[model samples]
Target: MTMDGALARIIRSAADRAAAAEPEVCDLCAAPVAEEHPHLYDTGAAEVRCVCRPCSVLFAEDGAGEGRHLLVPRRRLRLPPVDTAVLGVPVGLVFFVPRSDGTVTAQGPSPAGAMRWEVDASAWQRLTATFPQLASMAPEVEALLVNTARGPRAHWIVPIDDCFRMVALVRREWRGLSGGGRVWPAVERFFAELTERP
Candidate 1:
């Protein structure tokens, strides 16, 4: 099959698997959740929690809970023109999550786990200059996800939890040295879904 056809098939298969899985519950309230739900980033714990609507709203403000819990925004922005090489990630895919300390953590998914590295401040400044949206990403709750595998490089400002979800997907599906035969297409599908999201 062609690459696009194969990616569509893989996405369908993944969705089928999701449909067959048991429902999830709110991490804080224990309320049942749909297959898709809002998330909250626990800044203190550096983790994302699946939360019910009420709990999600409670932390919607950036300062809510004294910077403890920040609601992950649903906004997904297509980044303006930029060069991926400046980011300096060895992998073609990487995500940048802002830290409270005025720095960003650059990470990518790999067979081993989420591999992280320090981002060069000058390079980051260049990117933010080109795409000002990067500077406004909700601290500790959103991230910039970049995919540079092929074609025109794409970047998306997405929720921090989404980045972690991508990392988990990679860790779960990766095989062999070059991510085996199936992992790349799965990653493609992951980004495809993000692009198609409203």
Candidate 2:
């Protein structure tokens, strides 16, 4: 093939790859983005947004109206001795995150967030009995995940991403009643690793 034709083909191929690798445009502003992009919190809409770097950092500046949508924090904390009653969570395996709004988001066999299976009274009681430190979780962004199998452990205040990952595990891997064998084992392994964190 001619050098000019070859170069033209290569450029087209590169353009196609770039397009495929890019993320969908922001729902609010219609901006283009690369696959991995920063998020924007829209307080007026109470929604999370995928934004270009410029827009994302612009919102991060928190000028007047911009300050309303607080950035989701990235820090993780391993807290000790959380109060269980405040959470009213009854399951040993559960997680909760307080949103900017007063209510909390929870998951698992407990009080709040999203759950794959219902938690009975006994399950709730068993969980709260073992982990009391989860009560101290800061509302919004901070979450408490209790592993009853871990046995009377302190709370680990981690970024909300960690809780979401646990939810993904259960929803994706859990099978019939008791989440079958695979999910429970995976949950245990996750807790074991988290507890070992410094």
Highest lDDT among the candidates is held by which one?
1
Clashes of each: 0, 11
Q: Assess every candidate by TM-score.
A: 0.82, 0.54
Model 2 regions more than 4 Å off: 1-55, 61-70, 109-113, 116-139, 149-154, 192-198
Q: Provide the overall lDDT of each model, using Cα atoms, as 2-decimal numbers.
A: 0.81, 0.58
Model 2 TM-score, all chains together: 0.54
- What's the true lDDT of residue 12 in model 2? 96
Across 1-198, the per-residue lDDT of candidate 2 in tens digits comes to 999999999999889979887557865478877776655555566445666776665555436234555444445566565555545555667666555444555566422335643234444345446655444444444566556544456456665556766776777776765567677677677666764332
What's the residue-level lDDT of 93 in candidate 2? 73
lDDT of 2: 0.58
Cα lDDT for residue 28, candidate 2? 49
Lowest-sum lDDT 10-residue window in model 2: 110-119
